[model samples]
Target: MTFREGCWRRRLRGEWFPGTRLTLRALASELGTSVQPVRDAIGKLTVERVLVLRPNYSVQIPNIDRELMDEIFAIRNLLEAEAARRCVSVMTDADIDDLEEAILATRRVYWVESEIPSRVTTIQGVSRILAERCGSEALCEQLINLRARTAPYYAAALARSDDGEDAEFVTFTIRIQDEFVTALRRRDEVAAAEIRKVDLYTFQHYIYRLLDVE
Candidate 1:
C-alpha cells in the first residue's frame, strides 16, 4: 500500500484519538516518511470525513454526534440486513462453524477490559463471513467501510467496566449471535435478515448510550 493509504488505514482503525490534533510534519516523522505522503494521506482522509481540516491548520478526527451516529446505523441496517438475507441461501456448515468459533472466542474474553477490541472483532467476524458468502462485493465493501468508521466508537462502548454491565452486554451479544447462526442454519433468509437488523440497531443503541448521545 502507499504510505498515504497506510496512514488512512491506521486512523480508520482507531489508532488515533477522536480529538487528536495532527500536523503533517509530526505524522511524517512518526511514520518515518516524508511530509508529502503524510500530507497526501491527511488530504484523502479529510475528503472521506475520517479527518477534518481545521481553520487553525490542523487535522483531527471528526467528533461523533447524534446525526452522524444515526446515519451510520441507518446505512448499516440496510446493507447488513441485505447481506444477511443473501447469505442464508449460500452459507455452509463450515460457515456456521466459523461463526460459532467467533462467538466462542468472544465468550472467552468476557468482561476483560483490555480485550474489548478482540471481542468487537470476534463479533464482527460473523457479519464479515456472511458478507463474503453473500456474493455482493459492493455491499461487502460498504459494510467494511462502515465498520471501520464506527469501530472506535464500538471499542469505546465495549471498554465500559461498569459493575455487571459488561456481562449484560456480552450476554446480549452472544444471544443475538446464536440466533443469527440458527437462522443461517435453517436457511431462513427472512429470519436471518430481521435478526441481523435487530442486532445492528441494538448494538448501535448501546453505543449511543455509551456516548451519551441518545
Candidate 2:
C-alpha cells in the first residue's frame, strides 16, 4: 500500500490514542521512510479530518468529547445505513458466504476466549465486508473516513469499560451482527437499514453514558 493508504488504515484500526502528539519526523521513522512521504500522508489525512494539524506543525488525533463523538457517529449512522440499504440489491451469494464465515469466526472468539478486544476487531471486519459489498465506492470511502476519524474514541470507550463486564457488551455486539446478517440474507432492506440505525442508537447512548461520568 502507499504511505497514504497505510496511514489511513492505521487510523481506522485505532493505532493512535486520542490527543496523542505526533511529528513528521517521528511518523517517518516509524514508517521507515524519509520526511517527504510522511508529510504528504499527513497533509492528506489532515485534509480528510483523520488528523488535526496544530499551528506548530505537529499533528494529533483529535481529542474527542461527547459533542464531537456524537456528531461524527451521527454521520456514520446515516452513511452506513444508506450503504447497507443500497448493498441489499447488489449483494451476491459469495458475499453472503463471506459474511456467514465472519459470523462464525466471531462466535468462535466469543465462546472460546471471551475477549472483548478480539470480538470488537472481528465485528469491525464484518462491517468492512458489508461496506465493500455495498457497491458504492464513494459511500464506502465516506464511511471509512468517518470511522477513521472516530476510531480513537471508539477504542477509548471500549478500553474504559471494565474487563469483567465487557463480555456482555461483546455478546450484545454479536447478537446485533446476527440480526444484520439475517436481514441481509432475507434481502430485507428496511430491516437492514433499521438495524444499522438501532445499532448506532444504542452505541450513541452508550457513549453519552460514558461521557456523563467523565
Candidate 3:
C-alpha cells in the first residue's frame, strides 16, 4: 500500500489518538520509508481535514471539543441514515449477510476483549461495509472521512468508561445492529434509517457525556 492508504487505514483503525503530533521523520522511521512519502501523505490527509498541519510543519490529529463533536455527529447521522435508506434498494443478499457477520464478530470482540483500539476498529469496519454498499461513491467517501475523524474519540470514550458502562454500551450497540439487520432484511427503508439514526444518537450521547466530564 501507498503511504497515504496506510495512513488512512491507521486513522480508521483508531491507532492515532487526538492531539497526537506526528513528524515526517517519525512516520518515515515507523513505516520504513523515506520522509518524502510521509510528507506527501501528511499533506493529502491535511487537505482532507483528517490531520491538522501545524505552523511548525508537523501534523497532528485534530482534537474534538464539544462543538466539533456536535458538528461531526450531525453530518454523520444525516449521511448514515441516508446510506441505510439507499442500501434498502441497492444492497445484495450477500452484502446484507456480510454485514450481519461483521456485526456478530464485533459483538464477540466487544464482550471478550478489553482492548479499546481493537474494539473501535471492528465497530468501524461494520460501518465501512455499510458505506460501501450505500450505492453512491460520493456518499461512501464522505462517510469514510467522517468515520476516520471520529474514530479516535470513540476509542477515547471506551477507554474512559468503567466496566459497567462499557458493558452497557456493548449491549446497546449489538441491539441496534440486530435491529438494523432485521430492518434491512424486511426491506423497511424507514425503519432501517431510523435505527441507524438511533445508533448514531446513542453513540454521540455517550461520547458527548464523556467530553463534558473531561
Candidate 4:
C-alpha cells in the first residue's frame, strides 16, 4: 500500500491515538521509504484534515476536546442519518443481505483480542455501503471525509475503555447495525435515519464519558 493508505488504515485501527505526533524521518523509516513520499502523503492527508502539519516539521493527529467531539458527532449524526435514510430506497435485497453478513462478521471479531482491526473494518464496511448507495456523491464524499476525521478519536475512546465497557460498546454497536439492516429491509427510511442517529449518539456518549474521566 501507499504511505497515505497505510497511514489512514493505522488511524482507523487506532494504532495511533489522538494528538499523537510523528516526524517525517520517523515515518519514512517506519515505512521503509524515503522522506519525499511520506511528505507527499502527509500533504494530502493534511488537506483532508486527517493530519495537522506543525511549525516544527512534525505531523499530529488532531486532538478531540469535548467541544470538538460534540461538533464532530453532531455533524456525523446529521449527515450519516441522512445517508442511511437515502440509501434505504436504493438498497437492493442483496445489499441488505451483504450488510447482515458483515454484521455477523463483526460479532465474531468483536470479542477477539487480536482482531480489533478486523472489527473496525467490518463496521466501516457497513457504513461504506450506506454512503455509496445514498445516491448523492457529494453526501457520500462528505461522510467519508467526516469518518476519516473522527476515526482516530473513536479508536482512542475504545482503547481507553475497560474490558467490560468495551464489550458492552461492541454489543451495542452490533445491535444498532442489526436494527439498521432491519429498517433497510423494510424500506422504512425514517426508522433507518433514527436508528443511525441513535448509533452516533451512543458512540458520542461513550467518548464523552471517557473524556470526563480523563
Ranking by TM-score: 3, 1, 4, 2
Q: Candidate 1 residues 1-214, lDDT tens each? A: 7766775556444555456677777777777888787777778777766678877557876676678878888988989999989887777788778877876765665544455546567657766776777888888878877776776676666565364655686678779878988998998999989999988888788777777778
My TM-score estimates for the predictions, one after another, are 0.87, 0.84, 0.91, 0.85
Candidate ordering by lDDT (highest first): 3, 4, 2, 1
Question: In model 2, which runs have C-alpha deviations exceeding 4 angstroms?
Answer: 104-120, 207-214
How many clashes would you count in candidate 3? 0
lDDT of 1: 0.74
lDDT of each: 0.74, 0.75, 0.85, 0.79
Point to the candidate with the largest lDDT. 3
lDDT for each residue of candidate 2 in 12-32, tens digit (9 for 90 to 100): 766676898888888888789
Off by over 4 Å in 1: 8-12, 115-119
Span of ten consecutive residues with least summed lDDT in model 3:
205-214
Two-way lDDT contest, 1 vs 3, winner: 3
Poorly placed runs, candidate 3 (over 4 Å): 212-214
For candidate 4, the TM-score is: 0.85
Displacement of the residue 208 alpha carbon in candidate 4, Å: 2.5
TM-score of 1: 0.87
User: Which residue pairs clash in candidate 4?
Assistant: none
Clash-forming residue pairs, model 3? none
